[model samples]
Target: MNVKAQYRVGGSGLRENWFIGAGFGAQFFYGDHNRQMYFWDRVVPAYELHAGKWFTSGLGLRLALNGLQNHGVTQNGSHGTGEIYDASKWLEKQEFGYMNVHGDVMFDLMNMIEGYDYQRWHVIPYVGLGMMFTWEVPRSNEISANLGIFNTCYINESFDFTIDVRGSMVNDRFDGEQGGRSDEGMLTLAFGLIYKINYTDWNRPRWEAPPRRGPRRADAAKRLTSELRLSEYDALKKYKDDREVVRQEVAVLVPLPSATVQL
Candidate 1:
C-alpha cells in the first residue's frame, strides 16, 4: 500500500513568501514646463529598491523606495525685434532630485485567471497611492499615485528577472511648475532582479507527526500466547498421526501377535 505525504508548496507558508528586489531605469517627466513627451533629452536616471510578500499565488503587497532625478526646461519666445517669429528659446532650467516611499497591491493576472505555474513567466499589474518627497531648494511633499505592469521571468529556484514599466502622478510642483491643468507625472521603464529569501517546498511539511500508540503490553502478550498455543496444538496433532502410521506398519510386518492370541 502506498501512502501520500502531506505537505505544502509555493508560497504556502507566510514566512516563505517574502522577496527583495532592486532596479535601475530612466524617468521621463510630463508637464507644461517640458518641451514635449518622449523626448530623449528630458529623460533622467531613476532607481528603486523594494521588498514584497506574496500572500498567495495571485495576491501580494510591496513596499518600495523610488528615487529619481527630475528635469524641466521653460521656453519663452525671443523678445528681439527681428526675432518675432524666430520661435522659443530656453528660458529656465529646473533640475532636482526626489524620492517616493509607497506601498502597493500587486496582482498576478495570469495566475489569478488561469493558474499559478512556478516555472512559467507571469505578468503582474499593480496600483498604489503614496506620498512624494522632493529635495529641491524648497522641499515639499505631495500625494502621489502609481500604476505599473511587471513582466517577470523565472531564472532559477530563488531568482527572477523582471521588467517594469510604471507611471507616477504627483502634484504639479513635482517639476517646480504649476501652470498645467493636470498634475505632473513621470514614466519609468526599469529592469531588475528579485531574490527569494525564504524558499518553500510545497511537498514538504514543517511539523512533526506524533508517535504511534500501539496496543498495551498485556494485550500484546495475550495475542502472542494465543498464536503460540495454536501452533503447538497443530504440532501435537501431526505427531499423533505419525505414531498411528508406525503402529500400523509394525502390525502389518509382524502378523504374529494376532496368531499368538488365537493359539
Candidate 2:
C-alpha cells in the first residue's frame, strides 16, 4: 500500500475520499461464434453501481456490482438449459441474466502527473478480478479478469460526472461452450454520476492535509484560567509624578494709557 502512493507525495486516509456511483450503458460479447455476428446484434443493456475510496490522490480501491443481462451469438443448442435463452436450432442469440461483482485497484493518471484537481477531468485506469454468475441452467460461475478506464469531472461538491469503458475476460467455457478463441470477453461503456458522502475532495498533493472531522461545536466549554494563567501587579505610588516648568506667566496693565491721553 505504501508503494501505491508513489505519486501521491501527500498523506491521506481510507476514510477521506470515498465515493459511490451508478450508471447505465451497453455491453458487447466476443467469443465462440459471437465473432460471426454483427456488433450490434451482440449488444445488450448494461448497468453498474460501484463505490470506492482513494487512499491517496493517486491511488484507490473500488468494488463494483455490474449486471442485468449479457449478450452472445452461439449455436442455438450450444447454451445450457433451465432459464437460458432458447432460440431456433440455427446459430442465434444467446442472452442471459447475469451479475458480475468485481474489486479493482484504481490508479489516477492525472493525479500522478498534476495531483488532484477538482475542476478538470481525472483519468483513472483500473484492473481487477471478479466473479460472474450466469443465472441459467445449473448456474455457471466464472472468474473474470477486468480492465477499465474511468473519466470523471467534478459537477459540484457532492456530485461528479463520469464515463467508463471497461472489459472483462473470462474462461472460454463462460459462454457455455469451450471452442473458438482461447478465452471469452465482453466490452462495456457506461455513463454515470458519483456522489461523495461527506467531504468531497482528496487530501493529497499537500500531504499535510487532514480529513474533515466534523462541524465544530457551536458552544465549546469556556477555558478555565485558574490553574492555566498568572497575573502581575505593580503599585501606582512607586512611579512618582515628575514636574518641569518652561515659563511662568504674569499680567501688566496701566503703563500705555497715560501716554495716549497726553497725545
Candidate 3:
C-alpha cells in the first residue's frame, strides 16, 4: 500500500494571509491494511480547517478537525446461544456517530520537494497522519425521538424515550460488543489540491551584484598611454641635469605647452 495518499480536495483562500476553508472528502483505506473500510461500511464524513504563513515555501504544518462514522458489521452475542443468526436483524445494533471534537497535525508533504513554492495555484497533494475519536449513538433513538413505535410488533422493540437527551438506549455497539465506551485511536491519510491563490509575481529572481563599475577597453588604453608618457617625462627630467647638453637639445626641439608645464 502506498504510504502517501491525498484526501482533502480543492482548497483556496487569501495568500500570505490568514485563511479559513471548508472541504469534504473520502478517507481512503489504501494507506495501511488496518485503516481500510469496506462496503456497507460507516466511513466518517471528514472536514478540515487550516491556517499558516500566507504563501510560504517548504514544510508547513496545519491543524485539522475530522469527523468519522463506523458503520461496519459486527458479530452479535458472540458464538453461542441467543446468537444472532441473521445479519438483517443486526440492524438493531447499527449506530450513528458524531465527532464534534477531534484534531490532527497535517503535514504538507509537497514542501519536501526542492523549490516547491506555495504561492502559485498548485495542487499540492498532501497526506495526514493523526488521531480521531467519535461518540457512537443509537440510530433508533434518534428516530424514536420523532416517531415512536406505532405497531405492536415494534412496541416491545420501541426505542427507549430516555435516549432523546442522553442517546443512551439501544445496543448499537461495534462487532456486537457490549454497550459502553467505544473509543478508537486511528491514523488517517488523504490526497488533495491546495489551490494557492494565484499571484502575478510568484518567484522573484535573486539580486545580482550591480554590474561592476569598470572602465571600457578604450578608456583603459588611453589611461595606460598617459601613465607611460608621464613616466618618461619624469625620467628624462631627473637625468637631464646630469646631461645638460641633452636637456638643451630637447628644449630647443620641443616647446612645452602650458598643460605640460603645469604637470
Of the two candidates 1 and 3, the one with more favorable lDDT, higher being better, is 1
lDDT of 2 by residue, 1-263 (tens): 01123223564564577889999999988878877667787788889999988776677899999988777656644452323333443465567777889999998877565545667899999999999878786367999899999999888888989999999988888777778578887899999999976554554454322222333121111222321232211222223322112111111432344444554
TM-score per prediction, in order, is 0.66, 0.69, 0.36
- Score residue 5 of candidate 1 by CA lDDT: 35
TM-score of 3: 0.36
Extract clashing residue pairs from model 3: 6-190, 6-191, 7-190, 7-191, 16-54, 17-54, 42-71, 44-68, 44-69, 74-175
Give me candidate 1's TM-score against the actual structure. 0.66
Model 1's alpha-carbon lDDT is 0.73
lDDT tens digits by residue: candidate 3, 157-249: 111111000111112232234433332222223232232223222243211122223554456457667777887888888787669987888
- RMSD to native for every prediction? 15.7, 16.0, 21.9
The regions of model 2 sitting more than 4 angstroms off are 1-8, 80-89, 200-263
Which window of 10 residues has the lowest lDDT sum in candidate 3?
A: 143-152
Poorest 10 consecutive residues by lDDT, candidate 1: 77-86
For model 1, how does the per-residue alpha-carbon lDDT over 146-180 read when each residue is reduced to its tens digit?
99998789899899999989998988765555675
